[model samples]
Target chain A: MAALSPGNQGVRLAVRYLVLILIALIFIFPLLFMLMNSLKPTEQLLADTSSLRAFLPVGDLSLDNYVDAFKRAPVGTFVFNSVLVTGVTVIASLFICSLAAFSFVFLDWVGRGILLSIILATLIIPFETIAIPLLLIVSKLPWFGLNGLEIGWLNTYRVQIIPWIADGLTIFLFVQYFKDLPSELVEAARVEGASWWQVYRRVIMPLSGPVLATGAILKFLVMYNQYLWPLIVVQEESYRPVMVGLGYFFQLNVAWGEVMAYLSLITLPVLAFYLALQRAFIASIASTGVKG
Target chain B: MARVSLKGVRKSFGTADVIKGVDIEIEDGEFVVFVGPSGCGKSTLLRMIAGLEDITDGTLEIGGRVVNDVAPKDRGIAMVFQTYAIFPHMTVRENVAFGLTIKGVPKAEKAEKVAAAARILQMEHLLDRRPSQLSGGQRQRVAIGRAIVRDPAVFLFDEPLSNLDAALRMDMRLEIGKLHQQLGATMIYVTHDQVEAMTLADKIVVLKDGKVMQAGSPMDLYHHPANLFVAGFLGAPSMNFISVDTRSVDNGLAMVANAALDPIEVATTGRDIRTGSRAILGVRPQYLVPSATPAEGMLHGKVTLTERLGAETVVEVGLNDGSRVIAAFGEDRILAPGTEIGLAFDPRQAHLFAEGDRP
Candidate 1:
């Protein structure tokens, strides 16, 4: 093999990095546009929409649109509701899905194969097909909470949190990861006198860092971006998640600045959550051969 | 130490029976090994004893108690797995102490037990290292240490040294032997390696297709294999079998003749022998000595191949009937291919099996 000269190698490296940077900028363009437009006034925001200047913080910038966005709707409550729902849903979803996957992968129960196939079959059926039936069921569900016997779960935090806790993809991810773990460890744990629960708690769960992160990130994204379900179910202001709350800024000629500000605000939690688990998520993806 | 016994144990997956009907009595403090080829049900039999596999149609007892329904942990046994099932996320100390911790042993006592196991395994300095950080042999020691900390009545090893390289496998083999001596625990080891079985087992159970072919001490199995399968499976170069025509018999001996070899007198051992009946003569490669010239009532063959090692040499001989027999000799002689050599076998050392015989 012939080796390239240092100058030639440097040029090749520069071109590769240039292509990567271009692709990264293409992906980040919308977020930059949102941030930049959120700082501008309404007139300037609309004026810069046609040009590259819209992505840059060039003309008039201030936090006035943020203040106006809060004044327009219960932005604080929407942000709170989305974060609460996503966080609780992520944690609960990870626990429930991973547990189910463990049982599906390890324990030899009757009909396990058919049940796993049924669950995997559900993955192809888009959630949109089941949305109305799921909504109808939750609408008439009864809850015996601090209020002692509520009739309906609609327009409540529990309605949002409960239905999204377990899904097919997250369980599949966990099952895929757990299947590769040596079965001997589980057998050894059993011989060590551990019950199946203890085996899962100590031996399996501790070694499941990457899959847990993968499951959590996926659940967070799914719950955070929930729009149709929350829009139809949650009529009260306090229960509306961020995606549904974005509609508040859409009325009466659409306060474009407030719209930009609300979008930028809602995108923060997703970015932060992803960044926190990006290392483990990437590790899980690499290990499990799963694409993002 | 514990005595484990299985009575007519059978295992089947659906319609396929893996272990037909196995009955074994393992004495206390005796190191027993189940050695067989793949798919021979040795591992399954061990798993049944460990209570990891349910007994399909029999009873299993450990330490005088029928433990067929007992959980693996409650059966008073700890198994070292072939994969060295050390937790990759935990330090060596934590992995070793896992069983005691799960049993809710007090923290101080757990520490003492873990420390003692680590010391015995020579893993004191490696207690803080994760499994990924340790070498293959060290990780296996940690696995053994895990089983030791439990202090169970019986220790089960499932091909625990098969994953290591050749040199490490020998080293680990010696270490496991020493560990068995030091602990004096009743250990049941399963391996496909006959050498491991020969070197470490106080009692060896040879299995073929879920049935115990023969169970005895190493020397007993080696010298007196009951059947053709056991004879072929026990040794490295393997025992050679030559078909002979029994022409006549006299005085408790059969006069056997094969083409290209002289007729010899083989002891019938009181078995029914008729004239013109086919029989097989069995002799180990180590017993087939190479002679300089043709001798009376001897087998002769042309040398087809020769392998020379430092300590010994193995030579393959082609008989006139298109079958080959291997002869192993000490490094005193090296014969080239195509060299004609006469092979002599002591009548007392040779084994003869009638057609369709089991023992």
Candidate 2:
């Protein structure tokens, strides 16, 4: 093949960057519109929705909507609840699911293959099909918390966190990633007198940074954006997460600016979590292609 | 160092037998090599000895203790894998110190042992570097270093030098030999390379189809292979096999004749040989020489191809009976294709095996 001329190379590079920039703008336009209009009055926000001005801060702006979004509902409590649930669930799910995946990939026992298949089969079943039964089960589950023995798990953080700790998607992600690792590493560790737990903690987990980041980011998105399960289970305002708390802005008046402010605020945690792990997440995707 | 022994050790995964009843005795501080073709249960037998694979039947004794059910770590063995199996996440020092850390050894003792292993491998300067930063030979050294710190009685090597380049394989092969001498430990090495088995092993075990063909000192197996498989598997160009008919059996020698040659007396140790029975005559390529004149007990053939290596020339000859044989000459010979040649070998150097004597 002949080498490209210097002029052609420059033109090719420019066209590539132009296409990338257009794709970037297509994704960024919605977030820009939300942030720009969050500062505008509700009347101006609604009026500019049809034009590009909605994506720019061209109208009268103030911090009143931010204050009003916080005032109309307990946005602080809701954000705290979502972060707590998402954070705890992400950490616990990574631990439990990775352990389960380690067993599935490395150990040999009867019924393992069938059990894994059954867990993976749940992926095809949407949450709505099991949501009612799950709600009933958690409502009657026993818990001994700071308030002593409780027969029901409703209106508490445990109800949201425990059920999401061991899901098929997270375990499947870990199983596929663990399968790609060198089996010789595991055998070498075993021959060196390492217990199974020590092998998982030291040898396996140290090399699992990419998969851990990938699993954390995925579980964070799923838990943070949860609406129905928590909505049907918890009826208390104090235990309301961000997605359920978004209902407070949809009153009879329906303040669009305040609604945008609430959305923009809630989106921060998700963005921060993704940005912190984007390097490893991108690496995982590049290597494994998002098995989930 | 400790002696290792396998007494009727058999391994079967479900109904398929991988190592079918293998028995071997490895003396203390001896270097024994398990050599065979791929899928011949050489690696499977090594893994069974290492406790990485469970033994389905029979007993394995290490230092006079039956350890059939013992764990790998408790069996007092360390292994260097073909892939090196060095932890990519850890530095050289950390990798060597892993076993010591698992044992909860004192910090000072661990550091001193790591330094000693590093110095032995001449990798003290690379102790802080990760495995990714090192060359293939260096990573293999780190793996050996990790095994060295464990101070086990027996060391297992599963085709460790197969991953190296030709020149590097030779260099590492010498290093492993020197390491065996320095440590004076019982080392059971597995490889399919006959050169490695010949040069490095104090004792060689040849296997085929999950059964041991023969096991003995290298020269013993070379000079007197128990079966045709050992004869063919041990040599470089491999022994040339020609079908022959036995005319008479007297004492321990048999009178054999073929269509390409006159009757020749070849030594046989088989008790089942009978007159008017078929057999195979085996001769090494190095022993066959071109004769100046056609004579009795000489094979008549036409030269088909010649490989002129610098020191020696190898000629492939087609026998008159429509069979092919190779001959390696010490001095280069200018024999072109389609040239008639007469090949002769000493009777004592030829081996005779009864037909259907596989093991």
Candidate 3:
């Protein structure tokens, strides 16, 4: 190493940079180890756990674990169920939240303050605090138009979509966002002879690019990796999200090699999504802090 | 262009009254100014007319149509705010054409309107740049261009020049005057500067505590002020008031005097003026002149303070009984502090305020 200067300022700067790199490496080592573990053979894993030599096969390698992972579980069926429920919930939640938020903000309804207070009050409550009462409500779906249209949420796909909107956190996020938004922009649009729907579609929605990106990514992650609610509601093998299926996989087949490959497979989509949405994630957190 | 009127308009925030029953009638194509001190409810009244704030009481009529419940866009008025509220994300051309583009105007016609507005404001060179990239004066020009593109019947400016520097403010003032001369749009401007009101307005409205003190032309206000507040507020260095009583001179002629002056002629004959009324004489600083000795309409005093402001001297002359008045002088003034001096007044220019009457 080069000799540090006598003054402590240069030494401090060098030490801080080195510490940051070390912390980053420590945080990232688990993913690297997991990747290496997924590539090793059974014999080599039994031989050594901490050596680089054990990561590759001795003579020839095969994609046997991936094939076995697909055989032991209906991976395609799980992915379809996950994507379908998550897709509907994301679109529905965004539309409902933005509409309600715009109404509470711009329109001078009589009970606007009370409505906002009730929405804000839900933020202090956690979803787990109301899970039992929520499950009771979802088990008996409201009769809107037709008879025998009940959505018995235990072991059903409808269970996932209802809880997504019923969770007050999403509405709270939208309301807080709409409250701080500049009303001058909305007024200008109204002055230009635009209807309320036109204003929301042309002006409010276009201006909410960053918030929507962030909300979509956050909601997708929350619903994609859901386990507790899905476990309580879904009992059938074909109706669960991919995360619940992975947990069921470990219980039925105790083969650690196949399990490791399956878990790694399940993590790829979320990891890719994280990489794609890092910018939106940072903007949402930083800007929402300024909204208040 | 449209004329605007406010009949018995009032606004209150909870228990506090801000605008209390203000009525003003502005003529068509006439430029009027609302001038007052801060916290005088001037800006709030402008917002009520724009329909940005709800009218708590009374009616607001624009071009003879009641618009108290109508939305801001349908009010046929465009406004420029004090903070230069141009959209920071749009180009200068986009900002100018935003109102028409929202109205679904054709692209070719939108371009023509934007081009015409930019041409009038002389801002054609900076159309492609964003507001963040333009200078303060350039941004203000772009703001005025935005108002012009909409072709509003009544243009509302809420202290638009306050954000600019002094030199740019003067330049933009000249441009606005020329624009008014060309367009002849009905405009209502609000400012605390009396100079701006004097220089730009076809009529000036003086507001005090949410009430209109007086409304007239600049020269009418300067020459014939309805009360003491208007007389004191309109001029630089303010008008000076000396409490004097009416008395009989050697002949049957009635003259006015206080303590340090010879009697001055009084031709005022009204029931308000009598022998025992507590009346004060008002005179501007420039009207008082230094006299070599005591002459008709002359007063004697000792110089207390001398303020030389490059062009003229403002001398505070103290009377023998310890009251002082300011006198503006030319470059040749030689009065010094602690020196005796005499001054004369023109009786025709003096204003009288009775004790119990409004100024």
Candidate 4:
């Protein structure tokens, strides 16, 4: 291929940038529409839906919809519950799944291959198939709380966090990444007088940032968007997550602006979590070919 | 700094028996090279001595203490892997200091030891760079630096230079030889390359099928190999074996007859050979030469292939009995393929193996 002339190169660059901007707009326009409509009144929001002004903050802008969204539901408690549940679940899942994967990959034990296959076989079974039985099992599970020896686990934070802590996909992702690491490094550390725990803490874990970020992002998204399980198990409004609390804005005369405002609020945590680990997430995807 | 001894050491996995009854004594401060073909249990034997592999039925002693139950880190030895095992996430300085740091060495002492090792490896300037930024040779040096900093009793290298290119392998080989000389440490090196074993080892151990074929100095093995395997394995363009029949001759010498050449008499040197019994004659390529004068025991063959290296020329000859023998000559000779030539070697340079004996 021959090199293009300077004038042709300029035109080519302009076309490339135009294509990229258009692609970016396709993904971002919905979020932009939500954010702009969140600042508008219901009337203006309904009217602006027909024009480009739906994505622009140009008409009757105010924080009244946000205030209304909070009044219509316990948005503060819902946000707090979602963050706490997602944070605890993600942190705990990373530790548990990575440890499980380490055993499956490095240590030689009898029946490991069969056990790994059985765990991976669970991935093909959809959660909807077992969700009802899971709910019934968790409803009667005993726990020691402030009052001591509670028989039922409904309307509790542990119910939301514990069930999502360990899963097949997260363990599989960690196993793939750990398998790619050179075994010689592990042996070298062993010969360097590091115990297995020291090797895991000092050597393996430091090299595992990409996989951990991948696992955490995936677990965060799954736990944050929890709706069906929480809707069945959590009857009280105080323990409802953001997705289940979204029903409050869908009354007989639906408040469109309040819906958008509540959506924009709930989306902030996911956006912040993803953007925080954006580089590592991309690195993990590029290395493992795993998509979240 | 330490002597390693193995007595009847064996390894078996599910009735396969990878290493069967190996026994050897390595003196203190001696560089020993375990030279063998692949799957010869050389690396497994080394791992058993390093305490990385368990000894199935025998005892392993290092510095006069039985250490069959000891861990690798407690065996007073360090290993450099075939793939340089320096941590990719750590700087060269940090990698060299890892063993000491994990042992809770003082900071000043750790820094001093790492610096000393870096200076010895000539990698002081690249101490701050991670392994990914370094070249293959530099990474290998960092691995050696890691081993040196521990100041272990014995150093183990598992085909450490096999990953490098030819020129770099030669340079690194010289560097390792120099390191051995300067440190005077007991080192066990393993490789499938005979050139490396012949060049670097004070004592060479040849293994095959999980058994020691021979063990001696490099020249001792080159001059007098115990069996056919050692004779063929120790040299490039390996020693040629020709089937011959032995007969009684004058002065108690054995007369050898073969289809490839005329009958020749050789001194048996107290070997048990009966008349009319079959034997094998072993001769190296360097000993065989293209001769013009008609002589006794001269073989006639056609030159099938010729490799003209600048310093010497090697030619493969095909005999009437469908056997091939390679002969090396000093002067450059342009011999075309299918050119008939007379090849001859001194009787004293020939080796005889009994027909029943195997490697």
The candidate scoring highest on TM-score is 2
Ranking by lDDT: 2, 4, 1, 3
TM-score for each prediction? 0.97, 0.98, 0.85, 0.94
- lDDT tens digits by residue: candidate 1, A1-292: 8899999999999999999999999999999999999999999998999999999999889999999999999988999999999999889888899899999998989999999999888899987898999988998998999979998898899999999898889989899888989888899889988888998999999989998998888788889999988988889998999999888888878889989999999899899999999999889878866432
What tens digits encode model 1's per-residue C-alpha lDDT throughout B25-121? 9999999999999999999999988988888998899999999999898999999989898888889999999998889999999999999998888
lDDT tens readout by residue for model 3, A1-292: 7766678777898899999999997886666655555555556555556575444434334567667879988877787888888878888888888788878778878998897789788878887888888788877765343556555557777788766853456666676776666765665556545678877886778667667777777788888888888877788988988888887556753665566677677777778777887887787788866642
Q: Say what the interface RMSD of candidate 2 is.
A: 0.5
Per-chain TM-score of chain A in candidate 2 equals 0.97
Q: What digit string (tens of lDDT, one per residue) describes model 2 on residues B1-359?
A: 99999999999998998888888999999999999999999998988888889999999999999999999989999999999998999999999999999989999999999999999899999999999899999999999999999999999999999998999999999999999999999999999999999999999999999998999999999999898899999987999998988999998889888888778888787646778999899999999988988655798889999999978999999999999999999987799899999998898899888777766
Q: What lDDT does each candidate get? A: 0.90, 0.93, 0.79, 0.91
Model 4 / residue B175 / CA error / Å: 1.8
TM-score of chain B of 2: 0.98
Could you give the CAPRI-style class of model 2?
Answer: high
Best by lDDT, which number? 2
Candidate 1 residue spans exceeding 4 A from truth: A290-292, B270-272
Model 2, position B259: C-alpha lDDT score: 86
Q: Look at candidate 2 and tell me the lDDT of residue A107.
A: 91
Model 4, position B184, has a per-residue lDDT of 99
DockQ (C-alpha based) per candidate is 0.90, 0.85, 0.31, 0.78
| lDDT (C-alpha) at residue B340 in model 2 | 91
The DockQ assigned to candidate 2 is 0.85
Q: Candidate 4 lDDT, tens digit per residue, B257-284?
A: 7777878887765566668898888889
On the 0 to 100 scale, the lDDT of residue B358 in model 1 is: 55
TM-score of each model's chain B: 0.97, 0.98, 0.92, 0.97
